[model samples]
Target: MSVVLDISRLEPRQVLFAPSPLSELAEMLHVLSAPDHHPGLRAWATATATGLSSGLADRLAEADFLWHATRADILLPARPAATLAEELDALDERDDETFVASALEISCMAQYHRGVPQPLISAKDAQEARERAAIRGPRQAAFADRLLTDPRGVRAWLRRLFQDCEREFFADAWHDARTRLYADARHKTELLRRKGLAPALTAISPALQLDDQQQRLVIDKLVDGAGTTSDLGLTCIPTAFGRPHLVTMITPGWRPVIQYPITTPDLPRPMTVNLLQARLEALAHPVRMRMCRALARGSHTTGELAAAHGLTAPEASRHIARLKKAGLITTQRRGRYVGYQLDLNTVARLGSDFLDSLLR
Candidate 1:
């Protein structure tokens, strides 16, 4: 579904724009996990994949569940940390109970809708821990048992994974990206100061909408949830690695975060052609054309699009993916159904954009 932030109680001063190394690291790991989904990171992913140690590779696989729960507050600093090392130190300093609880939340979130079990933070005994762990699955159940028995060991293992990932690739990557990321943050901060929250959020992503009447910042996400801006405030981090989609951390315990794509001024002329081709190709298919026309009228779920076009589910999905990859459509998830809407603005600009690309 969507995450609705009750912004009525929030002040303009409560919304902050900052760059976070930890948030960037999370996105980097995600890109590494599935590079195919992130074309921009393909080269880096390929280069980095070659040198990963066997131990780190195994640890990454084992801890893959934690990345799914990136929304967990433990993985992120309350405010922007100066460096990845600084964030790592903060994470390492967390108490055993808090560390285990955060890990559990991350692992549970691997399967959508499987949120953290109740009273887990206060679970004092083994039976309670096992019961809470049972709700997650065999992997998490075992993890919970390990956490209860040896939290320090679990924390050490996770820390080592983070350290190894940094030492291997992200340390250098962050060094290169940090300046651009901070510049973007400063630009967003100034924009926020001048234009206020709604415009700033809109500038961040089309997936974000300020529902003024409802006093909510509505974020279009696959997962359905709600959170409020904490006394700690809301932080928006501009990321180089996190692109195409906005990542929100609205889980209850955390200071709400919106990790948005960095806006760059330069697009090489060659990239313009590539982007134009992708969009043109996405629109070229007859079924996709029909689907876009239908979507222009109103939003339609994949099943609805398939049924209307008399296509199989896989075929419909393939078409939808093409349009989505081209940035021609936006998705809004409501319960189990995700509805897609065509971006008429991008569609309208296609003609001029193509000409501009060719001429320039």
Candidate 2:
């Protein structure tokens, strides 16, 4: 199963590369909702989740559907907007029917993420929304009922939720990430011009491939669908928060957008000394050093690490967790037990990273 986008009619003029602040915010909200999927962002997401106001946390639970249907039309600007405020302003200017229709449409798609075999709504109407609301469980059902009964109010409520996310954390996060996002977009745009469309498109992610003969951009996905980029030209949005997955909005009536991951890992953040210290501390302990020596040879189960070190399972597990968090090791689950392996590259980089931190 895959998504095939016909690029036969796609023109260079139709292709756009820009950073979508609202889209990034939506993806960040998604990171908060499902931190496990984003291991690199787990720490920040956990802290952000802990610090959110009670009211905002409750709203996030209700709005959990947004993360799953992130490529929904309403969440994305019609054209590239320079700032988050600009995008939010454009969203505010939309008509009532557009808001209602988008909400209903996105709600139906959210059902699919919940593992529903078919969409809850066949027709995008108030009655269909009401019917879906009845089975959406308590939290989402309330959000759905509000959308059908008071669309305008729902719009305002959602805007506030988005605003709260920006004011609280995403503003700072976007500030830190925008430079990297913009650079990645520029690089991809240049790739399109210099290397041609196929290489440029596939460079966005490993899951994407271009079939030159078929004039199709084949995306490896679980769901199956095919569409042409005739009416809606392709817009490529590079997102820092959207790592490890690619999202597309090729559904009929939505502006086509591909929210792809940035090719490189996140730029090294500040607090270099603290980071180096944490890594050093992870290895400074005698038990951890021996564990690393053993793991350096090959992967070992938690039971093996414990037995070899003459320690209890809990003690070995604690050391393993600390080392894993410090980026010194990687873990793979094997049936009932978890296997741990030393991350040689990260360990080797520790010396250089420490030296660079001190001099630069």
Candidate 3:
């Protein structure tokens, strides 16, 4: 399925392009929590922030808590808050209720990123959201309560987060990565200036197809949200943290973001115990091993695998998701059926890496 955006009404200038520090910082948090999705990247980030203080590392790893506090909407700047500090400041300035409401929209992720955009909600909606969120767990509601009670705490947290990320690698890394990011921005602008919006988008990703009759840019993006108004246009951001996969996000009252992977694939593979441990730990399961064996037979659907293993579809799906995240399974789609196949090359590499890591 493709999300089709009507760019005919949107001016080329209205379609802004810039690097977002919030996007990068959020990505840093993502890789830490879900390293499987971002192969080789966590290794690079770990190396980049080698000199980080142990206390800071522990605090930074609390990305989920950070997400709960700032709300996903807080991170996507209304203007271009090019730095993390600026984004946090923008969030702190917003009414407490609106901020909490926007965050509740992103408290959970939908399938394949193909979920639809949540409509802008109100302060009363925020209160309702806090109550609903508390059903999942009280911590999120309590977190919002603290933020609402004392906004200064938000400012202080942002200062510390910005300091840690900047001192770690965001500054130098963004500087080093900016050349390619800027070049991409320039190229997309030129396409818009000459060939127009459709060409610029198609050039950005091969999966993009223009349907002039439909008045929308058809994209094979795995995102839930769809469409943005001409006033906000669409923000195109090239990000390092979201490497190897395109990401699309739409939060309440903010411009929609299409954060495509950076062109450069230069994630450094420094020898580290955690990298090896992550791979090894991924296989520490009987069900996953059984699923691996089932997959070895051939590319199969979750239902097919589940039936063969006498597993509930959800149970099989969970195992499959974990194995895939660990870089052991690759996916292929044929018509409506998506098949999962084992990645022998990665499994082989895992063995080699495990041996190599132990020696170090």
Tens-digit lDDT string for candidate 1 (1-360): 677887777777887788888878777877777786688789998888778887787777666556543445565556778887788788888777667666665544333243444423444344655765578577667767777778888888777878888898888999999999888778777888998877776777666778858488887766677888857578888889877557776666567878888766663211233567789898888888888878877889999999999999999999999999998899999999999998876776676554333233
Tell me which of candidates 2 and 3 scores higher on TM-score: 2
Worst 10 residues of 1 by lDDT: 265-274
Pairs with backbone N, CA or C atoms under 3 Å apart (clashes), candidate 2: none
The clash number for model 1 is 0
The Cα error of candidate 2 at residue 119, in Å, is 14
10 residues in a row with least lDDT, candidate 3: 110-119
TM-score of each: 0.67, 0.68, 0.62
lDDT of 2 by residue, 84-164 (tens): 878878888877766666665655444333322222233444555656655667777777777666777888888888888
Q: Which is better, 2 or 3, measured by lDDT?
A: 2
Two-way lDDT contest, 1 vs 2, winner: 2
lDDT of 2: 0.76
Could you tell me the lDDT of residue 312 within candidate 1?
97
Off by over 4 Å in 1: 68-72, 109-141, 265-360
Give the runs in model 3 whose Cα sits over 4 Å from its true position.
48-51, 61-71, 81-93, 108-128, 131-141, 264-360
Tens-place lDDT per residue, model 3, 1-360, is 446565567777778777777766666666665676667676865675576778777666543554422236555554656566677677667764465445545663222243332323334444654565566566656655555555457547756876777777678776776677777777788888888766777666655667856367666644334565456788887766676556655543457677776564454232233444556676778776666666655799988998988999999888888787667789999899889987765665566563333233
Show where candidate 2 strays beyond 4 Å.
68-71, 109-124, 265-360
